[model samples]
Target chain A: MRVITGREAVREALREEMQRDENVFIIGEDVGVYGGAFGVTGNLIEEFGEERVRDTPISEAAIAGAAVGASLLGMRPVAEIMFMDFVTIASDQLMNQGAKIHYMFGGQQNAPFVMRMPAGAAEAGAQHTQSLEALLYHIPGLKVVMPSTPYDLKGLLKTAIRDDNPVMFVEHKKGYGEKGEVPEEEYTIPFGKADIKREGKDVTIIATSHMVFKALNAAETLAEKGVDAEVLDPRTLVPLDMESIVKSVSKTGKVVIVHEAPRRGGVGGDIAARISDSEAFYYLEKPIKRVTGPNTPVPFSPVLEAEFIPSEEKIIDAVMKLTK
Target chain B: MELSEAKKLKMYRDMWRIRQFERKVDQFISRGDITGTTHLYIGEEATAVGAINALKDEDYISSTHRGHGHAIAKGSDIKEMMAELFGKRTGACKGKGGSLHIIDTSTNNLGANGIVGGGIPIAVGAALALKMQNRDEVVLNFFGDGAMNQGAFHEATNLAAAWNLPVVFLCENNQYGMSTSIEKAFKIKDLAKRGEAYGIPGVRVDGNKALEVYDTVLEAAKKARNGGGPSLIVSETYRWKGHSKSDAKVYRTKEEEEEWKQRDPIADFEQILIEQNLLDEDKIKEIKNEVDAEVKEAVEFAKESPYPDKDEIFDDVYVDREVEL
Candidate 1:
């Protein structure tokens, strides 16, 4: 076992996958000698050569489109968009081309690729900041994955590379520096499985990405208040682990879904709806609560940006509202 | 000049086939047989035939909205192409892809895209894939001057040259981008010269002359296969018909249309072959009859084919069944 930062875990996972399969290669802006915009691909060029760790021009559409074509033709191409906001520039390729290719071609062809990008408001302005998981995952053919811990990021990314489907591996700009335990031996975490980060009884808090840590912190605080909150992290959104979610809800009799994305059409809303839809609905003692970013864009001001992201206090407030 | 007699015959057949296919499509659409929008390749026969002829069946091609010629020239069966347009279940893409999205994976035709310049990036990726595997394959991306303004063109061009990927950017300069003339859209006349920005070679050829386009593309393909990187071949051509069957000739004059019509690619190529003793009147008549019959049967097949079943609509999205679907 080894302790590593989330950033190191990403690089290690890429390195291991590239070693395991020659068909797997990385391509994106500054992914080469520059080591990626966030240094997630550190020194990979030196080991894998420029061909495997290719540097692309500032063309997000081409980057995504090329990934689609490469994957369709039997190569596993992992493309990186510098920021999630820029994913809009490559949306046609991702949504129209990558997502629809498999179905449009009658299963005769598909683009097995991974589109990696850092999302959420990380003190970045309106243009560079966005949490697009809900928007992208809503597509029928795409798999949306958000890894909270170092071990999960490494394991899930490896799985994404191996899967014969297109996956959007979304990361948080702030989470890369966080450290966690990761085994040196190879492993993978299957999609649609929920991780019970903490066990409890009073209430359940369903969270993803940055919100998972926020909910864990809220759970710790709630424990002192005798609330005994359970924290559930559903790593993959497309293949949602409703089994674990509904089970937790049935046990706790209350639920609070947390996410950094907008509340209007975020995955949190879907999770809440599913909880109400399941047998857990009869077990519920209180209405479902959601801690989310407002419908407005993540602003430029520090105070505004801080308020835009859901805090531990917000999570605790939501949990307290449901539990009380 | 170095083309064998058999190759010459193929070149003539391909060019003639595209022209005849498009002619039938227009007639079908006019008679209310074929519904939906279509961008015909009536005058741009040589560009597709010549460029596609220079490519092997294994070599990939990405075509534009006006891509029937490229598809037919790439040896796509007229039956499936017509079936696709007719929205029949027996189409190349199984009816999901109508006229704008005809695909023939058997020949490495990666479907014609509806979005202008959309296919170029896909072609660049195909080339990048070959380059990654050390596979000796080249990609021919056919677009138009209309696509000249599309972000995809610039992005694909830059990526192709930057990676030294084996791809040829074949621009079909039909002088108009859906009624807006190329001169109005660009300051420069030679669309091939745009490749200079990416540090690649760019050359324009007479698109009406199938052999000339074939020669240019052949040279470009050889360069690509040898790892010489990408080149831009601008085939200066015209769209003798309107952009589609829906278009009216309000933007240009009848005089200009007639002027370009006199230099029809089929007539010009037929005369060239006759003078070179590669074709005679009897041989020409036989080829014409064969082409006409093939197109006629293709239309009849398309008309007789069944529409896709309602349940089949749910199929083809994901091979592994990403979800319960």
Candidate 2:
């Protein structure tokens, strides 16, 4: 085992994937000699050469379209849009073409492309800080994965690279430098399998991305107060591990789904509905709770932004309400 | 550098095929044999035929909503194309892409796009792949005059020029984008001049003249194949029908319509072939008969093709069965 940051995990995945497959190359702005904007791809071009680590012009549409075309002609291209906001410019290629090519063509062609967008709030204001994974999650034919830890990032990134369908692998910018122990061997984590971070009998906390960290912290706080909270981290949102969530909720008799995206139409609502509609609903003692960001743009100010994202205090409050 | 008599004659026949096929498609759409609306390429036949005829079979091309002409010119089978437009099970896209989205990977047509300026970057991408693979194949991307105003066009051209990717941007300036006239849509009088900003050669030509458009576009295609980078060729053409079957000629004057009609590409090419002594009247009549019979057969094939099975819907979502791409 080796200690690696989320950024290093990403870099290792790129290196390993590029080494295993010649057709796999990365193209994006500032992804080459300048490294990535977040340093996830630092020093990769030196190891792989300029051809494999392509630094493209600041044209998101062109970069995305080129990836799609190259994918069509037998290339596994991973495109990194500097910020999640920049994905708007390439929405046509991603939503219209990338997401619909297989279905529209009646399954004749496979769009084996991965678009990595560094998303989530960092007090960077309305545009740069928005966690827009919900927008992509709404689109069909796209697999959405968000890894909160270094080990999960490495494992999931490997799975995403080997997967033969188009994937939107979103990375929270704040989670990049966070370190965790990752095994020094090649292994891919199966998608749609939720990890039970902590087991408890009081409440089931289903969270994603950075919210997983928040949930784990909240669990620690709850433990001090004699409340054992079960924390579940769903690495992927598209092919959600609803079974695991339902099973956990069944044992605990209460659940709270948490995410950083706005509460309206967030993944939490879907999880809540799944639990309510399933056999797990009979065991529930209280209504399922959903803790999410406010229904507004991410604020630039640190104080307001803190209020916007779900925090340990908020999770503790919600858990206390259910336990009381 | 002149096109041979046989090639020029062949080009004329191809333009006629587009005209007749489009007219038939319009009729089929009106009769409800085809479910959706269609953008006819009847008036702009010469532009697609003239430009695509300059390319070899291995060369690539991207088309727009008004794309049947380009598909036929690039050698897509008329039967499968007709079925595709009709949304039949045996259609080029297996009934998934009706009318505006006919795609045939076999001919390297790269599918027609529904969005304006959508194919520009795709063409550039294909060219980039070709350059990286050290292939001599050139990509021809066709769009309308209205698409010239889109940012994708400017960005794609700039990137293509910077990297010296092998591509030719063929703009079929048929006067209007839907109901919006090019005069109202753009400030630049000559669409080809837009390429000057990217430091590439640009040419404006009479799209109705098959030989002229063919020769000019042939030169551009040759330059691309030889690694001379991208060129923008603006073909001044006209659409014979409304933008789609739903449109009425409310935007332009009837006199303007009559004036463009007088320059009918098929008629003009037929006269050129005859006056140049490339074809006798009997041979011209025979070619017309052959084109008509072929179109009829295509419509019949589309009518007879079966719809896809329900289970087929889940088949091609991912290349591999267990993993998503």
CA deviation > 4 Å runs, candidate 2: B1-6, B309-325
Give lDDT tens digits, candidate 1, residues B127-156.
999988899889999988888798988898
Candidate 2: pairs in clash: A107-B316, A163-B324, A164-B324, A164-B325, A165-B324, A165-B325
Deviation from native of the Cα of residue B168 in model 2, angstroms:
1.2
lDDT for each residue of candidate 2 in A3-110, tens digit (9 for 90 to 100): 989999999998999999988889899999899999999999999998888888899998888777667667888999999889999988888877777767656666
Q: Tens digit of lDDT per residue, candidate 2, span B1-325?
A: 6777777877878888888898898888889878879899988888888888888888889899898899889888899888888777888878887777777878888768888988888788778778777888899999999788888887778888988899999999999988899889988898888888899999999998887888988899999989899999999999978999889889988999999999998888888778888888899889899999999999899888887787766666555554322
- The local lDDT score (0 to 100) that residue A222 gets in candidate 1 is 94
Winning candidate number (lDDT)? 1
TM-score of chain A of each: 0.98, 0.98
State residue A324's C-alpha deviation in candidate 2, in Å: 3.0
Model 1, TM vs. native = 0.95
> Candidate 1: RMSD over Cα atoms?
2.0
Chain A vs. native, model 1, TM-score: 0.98
**Model 1 clashing residue pairs (backbone):** A103-B316, A103-B317
